[model samples]
Target: MAQPPSPHVERPGPAEVRDPLVLTELKRAGVWAGVVLAVLGVIYLAEPLLLIIGGLIFAVLLDGGARLIGRALPIPRGVRLVLVIFLCLGFFGWLFWYAGTTFAGQFEALRQTVEAQGAKLLGWAHTHGLVDEDRPQMVTQQLVGSVGRLTSALGSAIGVITSAVLILALGIFFASEPRLYHRGVAWMLPLRKRDFFYRLLERVGFNLRRLLFGRLLGMITEGLFTWAMLAAGGVPFAALLALITGSLAFIPNIGALISGALMVAVGFSAGTGTGVWAIIVYFAVHNIEGYVVMPYIARKTVDLAPAAVLAAQLIFGALFGFLGLLLADPILASLKVALEEWAGVDPHAEEGEEVASPE
Candidate 1:
């Protein structure tokens, strides 16, 4: 006898199954899109706040690492942190003292040179067709006027000193109690995702530290090498140029070009031979940096595309001025990491997938 007809089991309607999957995907996409828009909005609207907070966060993370190193070594964390801060303060103090002393000497020498040779130099330029007889005088007057205005502006900005002090105080406070903030952050997330969130924080902290240290190392090396070259070539104000170049190197592409241009100008001001030598030395140092220093330092830092960094700088600079340019790289790197993690992709993954052997 034939078995009774098999009991038919009904499947969910097409609408029922397709609707949930479609809804789930739309929801996921919507959440992510909202986050992206929110981040962009925050960056656009609150750039100054973002920059200050970012700087504080970076400082705290760096201090935290110093504390960790202190713990790992024989020194106490407090002692280590104190030493680190003192070293930093001492370095800046020494730099200012040196700059002031050198500037005083250079200023006197420069004044004597200008006074003694100003007319002769102007005549030479005019004779060589480099400038009209009146042009040199006009340019000199403009430069003097500009310098006076700059000095006046600086004198009027004494309040900036107080503001800087306040920022430093805030940074120190955060560095001392970073955990309190971290704990508060962790508390904001659901218990199930707290661990992941904490890990993300740690990753961000690590990346920021790497970027800071790498940039610092590269700047120092570049500055020192540039200074050595200038001094060897008998350039005036080698120390000052080195300091300027080093500080500017922290700014990436624009910084390098600006520093290079300044060096070349200083060279020309020194003399034709000096200018040529300076150009040679600049290129030599730059080559070493580009080939040797950057690659090595980058290995220890966050990997970011130069184009992306430049773009971010341009966008943020338009929105927030110089502060935005200073922070573009780190901000871009953080966003890059966040995007990679959110998309479940490895930022440093190999370009192609591996092939499987057929059985």
Candidate 2:
């Protein structure tokens, strides 16, 4: 005789929980508690994480630049990579060998120049009724004190040379076998969604590479142009100003503004005519870079808003100090890419579309 069919047992759907309300509430509480613990853990790991972030950025630069050169040359990628690394190291070595002593002296001179300029400006302000004469000393003391405290805080957070070394080492290792790291990260995702995550990673990586390329190109061009113009006009501390302008150019929007102000101040200190020339050179160079070059490149890459970038810098800078400030733009870009991918939001989607074209 055929056995009776086993009794059917209906399984509850995910949205249908048969557990008591108290048990559900306890589960929810446990989840929230776990989240809090995770946040605290992150805070504890902030130092190492910051260094890792630094390494990641450096690796991206190396990999991106090397890839570009490899595409142009007949040489193997590994050989090209070695060449790129050595060239970078050699450039830094030569730079220090050439300017180490002079740079130190120039740095001191820059400090003195800024101090003297501050005094001169204050006096001028008093003379022109821009500041109250009787309260000048008080205002100066307050501003100087605030700046000193802030600098001290920032310097401490940066730790020292050891942190720098750690970041450098990590970066080189990451660059050497980036695909391993890529695969490791892919492994962490759900198996079914691994392919999607891999694609997201590629898109995000390319976006980061493009952003960095644009920034690097801008830095080099601006620095060189500024140096050429200043040296031609015989401006004092031309080398130092060029260095400042170039390094600062790494930051978006406000970076140019700060560099420009510093140049103008130093320029005016030299002479009225020199100041006017510096302003003209700055406006011309940046206008070309910002309007023509940046737009063209951004159209091909990512077009981040100035306000959004500036805000990220300010927030991150306050939270993690220097590393935070440095990595803010890349962090923002990566987040944007991840969100767009996960949310299925088409960046180029038309306003009235029911289903966006994947293209």
How well does each candidate superpose onto the true structure, as a TM-score? 0.70, 0.84
Q: Pick by TM-score: which candidate is best?
A: 2
- Backbone atom clashes (below 3 Å) for every candidate: 0, 0
lDDT of 2 by residue, 159-210 (tens): 6556767777887899888889989988887787877777787778888888
The candidate maximizing lDDT is 2
Q: Residue 48 of model 1: what lDDT? A: 44
Q: lDDT of candidate 1?
A: 0.70
TM-score between candidate 1 and the true structure? 0.70
**Candidate 1: where is the Cα deviation over 4 Å?**
1-51, 57-61, 64-68, 104-156, 159-163, 348-359
Give the C-alpha lDDT of model 2: 0.79
